[model samples]
Target chain A: MAEEVENFEPKIVAFLCNWCSYAGADLAGIGRYQYPPNVRVIRVPCSGRVDPLYILKALQNGADGVLVSGCHPGDCHYIEGNYYARRKFAVLKNLLEALGLEEGRVQFSWVSAAEGERFSQVIREVTESVKKLGPARRMVKSFEIPKEIEKEIAEA
Target chain B: MDIQSEIQKIAARLLKNKEVAMVIGYGAGSAPNRTAPVFIDKEKDVGKLVFNRFCVNNLSLYLPRLKEKGKIAIVAKPCDVRTIVCLIQEKQIERDKVHIISFACPGLLEKDGKTLFASCAECAVTLPPVYDTLSGEAKEMERNEPFTDRVADFFSKMPAERWEMFKAEMEKCIRCYACRNACPMCYCEECFVERSLPRWIGEGSEVTDTMIFHIVRAIHTAGRCGECGACARACPMDVNLAPLAKQIREDMLNLFHHQAGVDPNAPAALETFKPDDYNDFIK
Candidate 1:
């Protein structure tokens, strides 16, 4: 288990808002910033579009960590989109914590299109925290072959 | 006259005058200690409407579905009326189309008729927040310790242990969705769980699937839950869902300073946000 933990490469899913965090990530790539290659980014039209279900689905589907990034307060291209997202994430975060998800498992951040370096720094912080927590076991779905199927395979 | 007679008289008058097309209220259940919702449309049938401790179901759950039946009257406990106000706020039902007949609730009892339900023990709203015609003067019941205080030890445990505790409770869920059907806030015509296109979670009662269903349901009903304990009562397996409901209620109250179903005009917690809403959790 210790060796497994040592070799663990956490799979993190990052939902980046198209106008801001996605562009910021592009800048990070162009600037060649050195950050962990752990996160798999999915661009969304707005951070407000990140349903709490998406985060839970990702976690249930075996994501070690999830990050949601959007425009800084008062800078959402759609005006108050991020503002609504802030309230939603706040409630969702509290609910997740209440259900025993670690504080760092799901994270929220504001990264304007211009803050490319900050986006890289956020990724590093999220990756480091997730690495310390190891692989998530709770809420991760598992599939087991039916007993009948297993017996058939054995007979075959 | 007792509150029951008063309610019947008012209901009869409403029906006699055609003030409402139907009155949705509780009737005698199959057993002595139970009550089932009954729809009455005739003045003479107003005798079927009864109010007692066993009338625990949140009758407001029928409001959204009953819209096509024309104007309706409902018997509401303080908690039930909150869901009514919530439905009106959500625009699921028109405020004017429904008449609320609320009484000063003598909190509901368990099946044994000895103990109060946990929700009534912590009875927060003694009076209906919005009522068209109230029947009796609501009496304040002695407050039990807050639900949060009851779960403080669970919260103090490590995250993994807490998850185990919550998962144990969720494992009892058979995915019958009795709780969902009992909830007035869950008015989505096609719930996300039923959507095959995205297939949000597995269909059967896998532990993870059960956990996610309860988790997402709690999240979906976050700001809107009335803490009415309807869902808990509806669970045939007797899974204790009070903790998740209470936690979300506490967060909604503490974080947003909002209590749902109280003021119909107040902006919904998730739908509207102040420019300076709490976001310290964000980095």
Candidate 2:
């Protein structure tokens, strides 16, 4: 179990807004800021584009952690995208928490296009928080065949 | 006059005046403990309209479904009126297209006819918030604590224990969309669950699928659920969905100071945002 914990690298899905967090990540790449590579980033046009369904789908599809990063308040390229996103994510996060999901399984942050260092720090913090919680077991959908179906198939 | 006779007289007057093309109200169900929604188009059918303890269904659910049927008058409980307000606020129904007929609700009974619905115990509104005409007089009834306050016991449990409880409740769901159908707020043209291109919910009653369905539904109804208890009563599996609804309701009130169905003109909590809203959850 000790070795398992040591070797278990968590898979984190990060949805980054195109105008800010995505560019922030690009800056991080250009500046050679070291950060964990476990996060797979999906760039959306705006933070508002990150539907709660997308986050839940990521968690359901076996991702250990999910992160959504957008521009700071009043910094949205679309004028008020992140403001709306902030409300949406706040409620989504609260709902997820109420359903008994671990505190770190889903994370939200605001990273501007110039904040490369902050983006790396945010990723590292999110990754460490998720690592402590371990793999997500709640709300994950396993695609394995049922025991009854498997037995029937074996017989056939 | 009794509530039923008053309701019938109102329905007859509305139909006789041709003010409403149809009057959607409750009629006797096959069982004594149940009431089914009935549409009264002619004055003769006004006698069929009844308002009793068995009138538990949220009649506003049919407004959006029957939108093209022309102007309609609905017999709504005070709680049901909240859903109509929510629908109007969401632009799902036009306020002018429908007439609301409500009365002082005496509260509703469970299907067994012996116990009061949990929603009734916490009900705060005895008079409809917005109505074209109100019928029977409302007598003040003692109200208990808010539903969210009562669910604090469930929320206070350890996260792991709460998860176990949620999982247990979710496991009992047979994936019947009765809860969705019964919900007035769930009037989406294409529900995410039924979309095949990007199937939001799994095919069968897998625990994960059921959990996601409820989670998304709760999110969808967050500030919009009127606490009408229609979804819980519609569940054939007897799964208690009140905890999740109450939790979202409490969060909406705490975070945005918004309650669903209270004001027809107020914007929905999720549809609009305040620049200085709470962001303590964000990093």
Candidate 3:
């Protein structure tokens, strides 16, 4: 018989757009959905409000996984906000992948307020995937230069 | 059409001077979208010099490396002309040794590519406001705000967020160094990044290594940048860093009231120190 493996709890960061995704997550909570408790939600007004830098920062700050959930396509309350985010994230994803980030480290999906079940399912899935991946090594911010050395650039 | 005959005539006149060795200008490529820098040696080749919407290279980056046989003539667009003005002001080159046949610029076209230069989108092409000889369309008026409001919006980003944006951009860098090579003001004999004794950048493309290269290059161009937007155009990753350039331009102009490559006599912002140079904001 194969050895029974222990289920791991992943540390996930969800950037939810305030208009729809956040409301969906809230509905999931009110409905007593058995979603994973690993996620720390940051409520932003629009998906465009979630800049790619914010994702990088979360990863640097030790997020095992990042889930950027927004309103469904053409559904952003702030007309065309998601369109900009779509362009930027597409670029950001390629850069991260080029930097050796695995496919599952960062994921984007759309979850509307009408789909509380989908939001619950996504959180649970992201948690499981990240648990398998262990942690994000590429996102660590290891570039801090010493102050005196930096200050003496002209003199040096 | 506006500049072809005029440039040919000027190149002929410049070649007559014994001290002048060459005339650097644009040549017709295979099509309308193409233009290349032509170094004119023979007077007959002067007819080859032409200017149009496609004449885009800043070309000043070449001047510092050339072991000039004698005085050279350059086809001066307003931006390249601005670069020359700064170089002359810095005594990097002798102004009299070169003849500048400045041409009125309508604007420049993007190199035939999927990725278009964003700077061309923001270009006013007017406040290259002065030149020695100009040809092409009727000159336009200088812009008052020009290229600042965008930088101001980016400035409103939280410092942490701003740093992250920069990180994301630098992360995409393949260490091509195209941005540095394309910059007209980056004409150091031995650039700080390449110094063996104290290499400012590591010799590899580790994220941190590339971050140093970009941060230093951007800072170095601080007040010297003429906002030509050449650096961002040369980037393969589409990491448009023009906001940093725009910010530096605005800050220098605001505090020092100095515009780079514009005035023949203006000193570099860092060089001529003033006891009363604004210190109120500095802690």
Candidate 4:
């Protein structure tokens, strides 16, 4: 809510679905893959399990970039869940780009349980993208709204 | 091609399922000209099922409140389908807990013979393309106005007039939270307006309070509203609030490339922040 101090480490929230992306991340860890340490993962059952509101809430609550990874097509633990995510992300990607948000802020990719290396590569890429864009506090336009409403919004 | 018979048939089958506690879909109202969301739990109620343009409510919004033990099957239009997808994505409801019956959805009928909503008319695609059951004529996608063009035309009006329009529309609000309660996305255990700790909104509500409620509600809806018209339909006062909600939904699409209820994997605009997110309006 104030001036950007030096040495600020951007906090990225990565929502990884348990069936695929989570296992992929664990694979990255087990293999000792090196990537930026910014992302904090919230694991769910499927990528389709990640709610768009939760992504918005994370951003509003001061997260910088959110990466959602799920099983590749046809591999979802729940059949066709990722397909629904694909349709949703297509629109979401368009909306994010239109808002003038940096293209890399909300990244989506298919990472199966075995794609450990691909998961690491994605995290590295997302980190690089977020790094070039810099700190994202300006992403929200709600600063000037009244205090009462601000309190309510913060509560939201 | 009459969908009423099909709906009744589905309702009958749903009621017969011991696991299905209810089947929430459109039903004929007391009047010929109106349609409403009907929760059918008993076999006798299957006769109430109806399908018509006046059946504009997105019955899926009633999903989150239902007890999880019983399966609930819902009839969804393409637009309503997105809401169902969004709900499942958010973990507000489990995907396996409910069933979906859908239509390729020729879009909403205005009860005046119109085939689509103003937003639906401009929409570029049909989604969640698969369904548990299908109904109506499978409509082919067609080109129409762009969402932004309609928005620009709407906003080109005088500012004071626009404010007057909003104020007039909002004056009809009754603090029923019918709109909130009718929304599938508004599944918070304790909604912000209901909290007293910081008292987000004073409970001794009035026109001003009501206005604040709607305005903030619209803002909160920013990218998440699906334009189901559930708010206006549920409103006892008929505030005709869909226009405002639709605007933000379009803006979210036009500006942020985000559509509420469409995708499970994609992050919402404010949810997953980018370091360089557009904040031109922030002071």
Each model's lDDT comes to 0.88, 0.87, 0.69, 0.67
Q: List the lowest-lDDT window of 10 residues for candidate 3 chain A.
A: A1-10
Candidate 4 lDDT for residue B255: 52
Provide the global lDDT of candidate 1 against the true structure: 0.88
Residue runs of model 2 more than 4 Å from their true location after superposition: A1-3, A145-156, B143-153
**Model 4 ranges off by over 4 Å:** A1-156, B11-21, B42-45, B109-130, B141-154, B203-207, B279-283
Provide per-model DockQ scores: 0.76, 0.77, 0.02, 0.03
Classified by CAPRI criteria, candidate 3 counts as incorrect
lDDT of candidate 4 over A15-128, digit per residue (tens):
888988899999999988887798998988787777565565566556778888888667889876766655445445444443234566677877878988888899888877
* Model 3 lDDT tens row, B135-166: 55555633332232334455567644665666
Between candidates 1 and 3, the one scoring higher on lDDT is: 1
- Residues B131-198, candidate 4, lDDT per residue (tens digit)? 67776556664634222233445456554455455556656676889888887767778877787775
TM-score of candidate 4 chain A against the true chain A: 0.82
Evaluated against the true structure, the overall lDDT of model 2 is: 0.87
Ranking by lDDT: 1, 2, 3, 4
RMSD of 3: 16.9
lDDT of 2 at B14: 81
Q: TM-scores across all candidates? A: 0.94, 0.94, 0.59, 0.57
Clashes of 3: 2
Q: Report the C-alpha lDDT of model 1 over B1-283, residue by residue, as the tens digit.
A: 7888899999999999999999999998898889999999999998988888878799898998889999999999989998888899899999999999997787787787766787777667878888888886666645443233335556788878888888888889999999999998988999988999989988999998888888889888877888788998888997878778878888888989999899999867887889888988999
- Candidate 1 residue-wise lDDT at A120: 96
